[model samples]
Target: MAHLPQVLVFGPPTIFTQFEPQYSHKYHFLNAWASSLPLDQFLHTHNYEPSSIQAILCAGGGTPVTVHVLSVLSSVKLIVTTSAGLDHIDLLECRRRGIQVAGAGSLFSEEVAEMAVGLLIDAMRKISAADRYVRQRVHSGPWDFPLGSKLGGKRVGIVGLGSIGFEVAKRLEAFGCSIFYNSRKEKPFISYPFYSSVVELAANSNALVICCALTEQTRHIINKEVLLALGKEGVMVNIGRGALVDEKELVRCLIEGEIGGAGLDVFENEPHVPEELFGLDNVVLSPHAAALLKSLPLICVTLWQGI
Candidate 1:
């Protein structure tokens, strides 16, 4: 009998349902936590024959599973992923194993950028607080929520002007906001003012939007210093990795009014937000669902074909 090429997938089943819907039956899926996975036990229990597995796919964030599975599947030919961040993938290991890795480039960039804009606007306008007030039947009198700043006249700073950050700048440009960016290398194509450092960006702009990729160099890049630079009048928005921001410092800054407000889609410890931020009216929180949109399925299909 001819051997069927075996593919192993480690991620949400929904990605497979979206990417290879018709060919789903051809692959074997071992759904495991993106960050935490017991590789030895999982392999022993499932009888995972590494030699038989031809390809592996990691759809979620981080490099843990990619490292674990690639260490075992030395002969696997391909490592396909839907996520753009490869910090979770061990490229060195893949190179050593002769495994080719592919990913979606800017497919989800616009989607994530749009969410970042939404979070910024929501935070500035206190949309969540207004919604809560309405929900709690506090509408007996005239609504007195203070008017928010308009994006058109404000100085907007974007950290790490990569794919998503560039898209965010383009979108914010339509609102007439003056855009400033901070990246290691200045983008040749963009004409916007560039800051050499994150603190410089924070110091100049009224609102700071973080859309950088998370890496060893960028982990917890936004700390108390950056927050203090933002000052009490500035608003902060993070659509990037939670690890990029210091959560404890953020709570301290917010509580002490060091910064005006914040909108966060991703937290340092996800699904479990800091209890201190719960009662604060200036904060708008999301459950790391910024990248998840209705168009994600179509985007996944497009990325698969490109790979």
Candidate 2:
């Protein structure tokens, strides 16, 4: 048998369960999750020599590929992450070592934009809340239904006008939303109003959608001041990293009615959301699954081609 290229896998068991069958013939995956030893120890003790591992397959944002991990696997030349967000990986370290890093670059952009729009619509129209009321309260007593704001003619602000953000703007335009944006720098071709300051953007917008990359500069970019500027009638939607918004302050804002509504697809902490948000009618919460594709095979195929 030919010696297939060895690739170290960093992520949960499902990463292998979903992908191993298709790629097993082309590559030998050294799954770090199955080993009892620590990741570094596993790297040193796997049946194949560490030098044989020339690539890493990172499935999601959960497992971070730190500098230490890179130092241990000196032979690795490439790192492919399934997530579009590169914040989880130590990119600067990868650059320093001359290692190539790749992400799901525009593969999930359309779908994530769709998700942002869906969440925004749900939050603005109180669709989810209405559904709950119909399911639980329609038969009980009074026919009091909560009022929701209209999407048309709303001043919508998009932070980080990258691929996904652009898609979001295009979709929102069809809904008659007046699009405004704040990015690293203004794009010359675009005609939408630009705000260099996010706070200023929030003050002008009826809704704010976060779709930027998460960096040290962008961490907690949607702070209390920004939220305050968004005001009582504003809606906040986050399809970007959870850290982009101060989760604690967001919870407080929701509880105290500092902001009108929120549609959150990401949070500062994973699998753990602030309990205070659970009861709010104007809040829409998603399980950080905005980029989930319907066809599993297409996803794997895209990820493989990206590598």
Candidate number of the best lDDT: 2
Model 1 TM:
0.88
What are the lDDT scores of the predictions, listed in order? 0.79, 0.87
How many residue pairs collide in each prediction?
A: 2, 0
* Model 1 alpha-carbon drift over 4 Å, by segment: 1-3, 18-21, 33-37, 305-307
Query: lDDT tens string, model 1, 26-127?
Result: 555554434254766666676767777777766544334456667677668887787766666778888887778887667789888998999888888888
Candidate 2: stretches off by over 4 Å: 12-16, 33-38, 41-51
| lDDT tens per residue, model 2, 28-50 | 88888677677767866855677
